[model samples]
Target: MSNSEPQRQATVADSQAITVQTEHGLYIDPQALSAHLPALSYRDNELYIEDVSVSGLAKQYDTPCYVYSKQAILDVYQAYSDSFASLEHQICYAVKANSNLAVLGILAQAGAGFDIVSRGELMRVLAAGGQAGRVVYSGVGKTYSDIEFALQQGIGCFNVESISELSLINEVADQLDTPAPISLRVNPDVDAKTHPYISTGLKDNKFGIAHEQALDVYAQAAAMSHIEIVGIDCHIGSQLTEVAPFVAALDKVIELVQALADQGITLKHVDLGGGLGVRYIDESPVSIADFADALLPKLTELGLKVFFEPGRSMVANAGVLLTRVDVLKPTEHKNFAIVDAAMNDLIRPALYQAEMAVIPQQLPNGGMQADDTKTWDIVGAICETGDFLAKDRVLALAEGDILAITGAGAYGFTMSSNYNSRPRASEVMVAQSQQQLIRKRETIEDLYRDEMRWQDQ
Candidate 1:
């Protein structure tokens, strides 16, 4: 009965029994919703993000827009910063979550570093005013140009995933006549117990060097003149509902660090790459503070600079996908609420089978009957049968109703596409009770803005 065990058990219990009944499916249990989305509330029967009403945002931006609470993003970052205040650490926000320049700008201003996987992401961090020396590049397949670009920018370090990549980076650094900071991303073979699509710390996954070979890799890295071995890192996976996997991964990382020290390969930092999951459905993820409390005692004993790359935990609950019901169709086997927002706007549901809370801005005709509580497959206008935001969702709604799909801040717009030539949606940030459009809705012309029709022969 450790201190965190009871808390974990309680959260699991709460998630199991609590379901806020809606029209057909259940909204996120209020307890989990409040824990994750502290800035959201219902006022005048309308869902609001911070002080901006969902109704008002729909009216102004039209439907199928992204609405975020500026405060929510700040709050989550502050929680991480405050919880580890006593430690030497850097909260390197994973940029792939939501790379809207404004999102990056806000994080950069808050003294957050960045974890980038691509050269374009490196440019975005710089464009958003993030310091070059605070950026950490992580990915398995960084190209020659990627290595050249990162070295030119003088990034903090590269979380090298393979020996080949280390050699390539060394070559690039030598070509540029500079020392490149390197951190071997060791595959700890720990089961993150998450979705297969995201699990990265296993031996079979093509993410990092194997755990047993990490010491040898460190020795190889030390032999390279252009490589400055700075740190050790491992990311198990994303959307982790429990803290045990992270702890397991870190324990292995620490063991390797000691082994490397015995070999005279001293490290500067220990990067516990972030995959802390947020409550999307019935998940009871460890709170950032509790997670830190669980690991800080051991982390402090190591006395090395700590680095984190939290993505979803920082932004998933801060934004909502605002969509409008376009039409309702009922058949013998199913009821459908087709929305204007399609798979091109948010792909998690179709891709990952992910679930999110879909709450109507107002109930159908402001009321619902027992029969009106029919379960509806909330789908998008995309032609694919798989194009859905949520299936068998219970929601009280009308044809023209607006729905806020909660828990969409991370991996939402960043994963969006222009498939079917559908223009992407706009984005709005609500702060201090005021709304500002962060991204403009793409126009039909913008879809073909760069395409040129071939001349007739």
Candidate 2:
């Protein structure tokens, strides 16, 4: 089928049955593919992301690049907006997940306010055409200058973390002669039941104020001359799969909101910081519809504007890291497939022990034969032993074969680095058959352009 031709949905006899496309054939399970990814599918023995061939992108962009489906992102964002359509809510796309200007621009144009952590993120949101009034500043550390910048921009609210940070914001606002819109991020201490590293609501985590101290803190904020308590905020953690923890957290937040209201502190909104999970493997995350169904009623009863700071769920599965196998080594102990993309290119696998689904861009004629497949450790070129992508993955592979690392759109490039002095990869956004290079691949000199040379010194 041509790239411009609309893809026909394949009917399946059973959910597990692999649907064979007779015309321009390929053995693919459409149901299984849809369950994992939205805009990706197999056609003519090649994987296509929104009708744009993944292998074609690898060849065009020259491997070790990030490719995102524009439609996928829009669809996901639309789903979130549609689910909460019944409520007075704002779906603030968390900019920290994937801060690429194009991604930001897409979300901004689609009416997504941003949840930023720093001045730089706020600037990025503005540069991408997002309104400062729709932005919510959030983080543990906010320097005087950062607070001043955000205040100058007239951001919607500040998700104040600590009491000291709250004081700092008030101090900056006083100097600016402006009442800074704020939200005290309360630590509900509700276990998000996610990875410990990503969990932020626990008392031990340095994210928000203790749940018990929220009312007292609000009293403190209420007394501050320059601090305007516009709302309350709480983010338990990232990659949360279940709805119980969210409902539990909301219940606590509601209780606190009522207590504050009783104290004559009527807030305008409630920021239920987002941690909705996406399917990285066999995991069944709560659907956006289900999430809204779980929390919308309580929020409606509260009769306050709602704000969701979704990061991963907005873009994680919308993009992939495209890399080529540079070398294949077979040893008695273990088999290793070293790809050009390293930990510096995508670090979640190393940092969070995240397991991303690695699949070939192009499949063999009749899929992989038993002899052609082997259990291989997909390692990167980085020097660290922890620099690995997938472990003990059974796949039909060869040197020079292009692979797509799924679930890379969120923290993949945003958390990447130039470790080992390796240039960062380029980023591309695919919309149907058309492709656009959102970011250029970094050059070796680009890395040290701002550094003072020893000879010059």
Candidate 3:
């Protein structure tokens, strides 16, 4: 059948059971793919994100493109907002998750604030029409220029990580003659029970001030001339699946807040840093509502403004990385499906040892039929041996078949690099079946645009 042809449903039966063929013609996996991917479905034997075909997107935007569903993003953000409806809060979409201008614009329009870790991110938020008063500046190493820039922008608050950072912000604010609204990101030392790399609240991790030292730090901050201690914040880790750690961290934060109040330093808000995990493979992470439900009561009792810095939970499932298989090499030991998208396009698989869902853009009329299936290692074109997307994944794939790398919306493009001098992929956003190219694919000439060859003697 042609790539654009409509899919016709078919059924086959055996003595044991009968299997129904979906639009993409997969029969073996009985579970609906749509259940996992809310915005994804098979239409006419082609993968459709909402209403647009993935193959059509691949053809139009070229492979290795990052596609996002606007509706999906809105839905996730709204879930967070609705969950905290009873409380005074701000859902600051972490800009690092999917910082495409179009993505930021959509969230900004949806009344979502931003939690930024850099001045560039702050600038992106501004460029995307985000309100400066709604942006919170985060990160451990905020340079003088960044501090001065954020202060000038009238940002909502600075999530100060250290005493030294507080001193720096105070110094910068003094220099700028502006009061810097700030919060101390206290390390509650709560176990996030997640990957060590993403864990931040542990005492050893270099993220926030120690929980024990936070009261003294707050007292010190209250005396600073140019500093206004606005809130208390804690982030345990990224991709957190449980609620106990969050509650534990909040319990510590609440205690600290009360201690500070006794010391005549009352915070106006409390920020529970966003580390809620999303479903990547077989893992079942906490739902947004459940996560909020677990923490909102305590926050309400504290009677302070609440802030959530959700990055992955807000965008991870809203997007996929589209790549085309270049060749299928069957080796003596293992099989490899070499694809055009390398670690440069999506690095979570390499960096976090992340397991992502890999689905074919088009499935055959029947299932793989056992004999046709092979356990293939999805390797990328990057030169490093570690440049793999998935290993030992059983799939029936062929050359030129497009694959959707699921759970790629977060930490996908933002972590992308021009390694091996390869240009970065373009980004597209789908809103109501309309495809919008948010970022143009990088060109060879675009690389090193700022570099100049020095004349040698």
- The estimated TM-scores of all candidates read 0.93, 0.93, 0.93
Looking at model 1, the pairs that clash are: 24-394, 24-395, 25-393, 25-394
Compute the lDDT for candidate 2.
0.87
lDDT of 3 at 277: 92
Question: Candidate 3: worst 10 consecutive residues by lDDT?
Answer: 1-10
* Tens digits of per-residue lDDT for model 2, 138-244: 99988999999888888899999989999998999999999999999999999998999999999999999999999999999999999999999999999999999
- Residue 175's lDDT within candidate 2 is 91
Candidate 1: C-alpha RMSD to true structure equals 5.4
Highest lDDT: give the candidate number: 2
Q: What is the C-alpha local distance difference test score of each model?
A: 0.85, 0.87, 0.86
lDDT of 1 by residue, 1-457 (tens): 0111011123345534334444334533333354446578866556778887888899999979998888889899999999998899999999999998889999999999999999999999999999989999999899888999888888899999999999999999999999999999999999999889988888889999999998888889999989999999999999998889988988999899888888888888999999999977567788998999988988999999999999999999888999999999978778899999989999998888888877777644444344456677899888899999988765556788888888899999999999998999999998968989999999999999899999999
8 in model 2: Cα distance from truth in Å? 26
The clash count of every prediction, one per candidate, is 4, 0, 1
Better of 2 and 3 by lDDT: 2
User: Candidate 3 — which residues are off by over 4 angstroms?
Assistant: 1-31
Q: Could you arrange the candidates by TM-score from highest to lowest?
A: 1, 2, 3
